[model samples]
Target: MSAESLTPTETLVLLTLLAEARPVSNTELKTLGPELRAASRRKLTRLGLVATDTSVRPFTHELTDDGWARCRTLLGADTPPRVAPPVRAVYTLLRALGRHLDRADLQLYEVFAPATEEVAPVDDTSPTVEGRIRAAYRELAREPGAWVGLARLRSALADLPVDEVDRELVRMNRLPDVHLNPEMNQKALGDHDRAAAVVVGDTPNHLLSIEVA
Candidate 1:
């Protein structure tokens, strides 16, 4: 569906997810602005604009890659029909920002990027290699338990020894909260993705996820 076809509530939901740039629960969505009830959630999922992980209690929602693209289109779009004045004002400003971004050649991800919460600080002898791995995962994943590509994870921990990182990943997978999964779409695997995979039980797992406390 085109951006123009989206209802005001749907548009708001997309905007909220874009602003968050992380997995948000339906409950939290209410507090943020839009209440993403069953109908809207299903519609977005069907349209490939959102991904909902229902495996966990209080299912979490995040924007898919297509969702991000759709949101970027909204930057240049006119405000949806029947929106209130405040929302129209938001779109007015968004259009202006979109023009500036276009002139500046900045992608939306560069502007609405997730903040790095944990990383290897310069102080030596503090965080262990395992600790560093966890930090890297947090920086990359949309939420806890979200599947993060191993290739991206390894890039974040580039300073560490490759063997050491792989060994720790194997050990961490045995934990209850940690999981390693193979990319089901094997055709999408590039050389780097294949090379970065950690083999577990003879399976080359290309994704890593750790449940947050």
Candidate 2:
């Protein structure tokens, strides 16, 4: 369904998720605005606009890629019918901001990055698979956004389980700052490289890029 078809609460939920750029629980959502009730959650999930992780208590929700695209559409859409005056005003500003972003060739994620928290260094402890992947990428990449072959990357994390590493890679790829790509120069791939590839969806990604913060 289009952004115009979303209910007011649904609209708020999507926008909040977009702004937060992190999974939010119902309790946390209450502080921002309306809490996401079960019925609304089911509708959003059914529409493939939101992803709810039930593994945790109070369940946390996050926007899917489709949800992000839906919010983008709203920037150009007319305000939904019967919205409060304040919300209408917000939309007016959003449309204007959207125009500015379009002219600047900027992505919404670039403007609404998730907040980073400072933590003590983890030099004494075993690093997470995701952390190891980032560390390996940093070592191999001459600069941020430089493509590092998965074969070489995997070699650095060889002690870690291949399946576990692949799962983390797929998850990391979903983030705006991380990218996984198949080598366009297919003729250059050796057997070792092919074996090291991680399959995301139907594509085998041989290269990794992580935007260093």
What's the lDDT of the predicted structure labeled candidate 2?
Answer: 0.80
TM-score of 1: 0.56
Instruction: Estimate, for each residue in 124-174, the C-alpha lDDT of model 1 and write its tens digit.
Output: 344677788888888898989999999999999999999999877865664
In model 2, the runs with Cα more than 4 Å from the true position are 1-4, 116-127, 144-213
TM-score of 2: 0.66
Off by over 4 Å in 1: 1-4, 120-213
Per-prediction TM-score to the true structure, in the order listed: 0.56, 0.66
- Candidate 2: tens digits of C-alpha lDDT, residues 78-125: 887789997898789879989987998665655664665232243424
Q: Which 10 consecutive residues of model 2 have the lowest summed lDDT?
A: 117-126
Model 1: colliding residue pairs: none
